[model samples]
Target: MRVVRGREFVADRAWGAEDIASMNGVSTRLHWTDQPYKWHVNDGEEVFVVLDGKVEMFFRENGEEASVTLGVGDIFYASVGTEHVAHPVGEARILVVEKEGSV
Candidate 1:
């Protein structure tokens, strides 16, 4: 079993990325905080789990911009080619899991 302390993980500057497929279809936890006014697009589907604080997920659908606020324990999934931005309301800790061979 893999265990992580959220507080310490957040305090660290460099976080390592791991492959879940090597771990037998398991999910790995990740802590991330992006800069304000920045945006990202994923080539594949991804699930974001809010562990602490809040995050606003911004997206555009049908030429209209939309947003949703996600708090602790809230989860959101984004599909491939989805354009969006995430803004942390406070210091946010999130767990990112990629399914095996998903990419």
Candidate 2:
């Protein structure tokens, strides 16, 4: 059992994460970042939750690019082969659940 203070969490670099659990080839993690992540497609489904600050989530669909601004408590589910990237509005803490060893 554990309690994580999201707002107070810090990482030496962007996207650094604290592993919470791993089960059945899936992992849950808490990530701290202030930088944008590279665009890529996930090999499996991913659950992205904004825990603090804001994020501009960009995704590609049907050969078009679109984006959405996500605030606290917002969730973004990325199905397999979904191409996307995340850019934080500033410093943000995010909780992510996805296949173990996935980038």
lDDT of each: 0.66, 0.95
Candidate 2 per-residue lDDT over residues 18-73, each given as its tens digit = 98889999999999999999999987999999999999999999999999999999
Where does model 2 exceed 4 Å of error?
Answer: none
Q: Candidate 1: lDDT of 39?
A: 64
Model 2 residue 32 lDDT score: 97
Query: How far in Å is the alpha carbon of 84 misplaced in model 1?
Result: 0.8
Residue 17 error, candidate 2, Å: 0.6
* TM-score for each model: 0.72, 0.97
Candidate whose lDDT is highest: 2
Stretches > 4 Å off in candidate 1: 11-27, 99-103
Model 1 clash pairs are: none
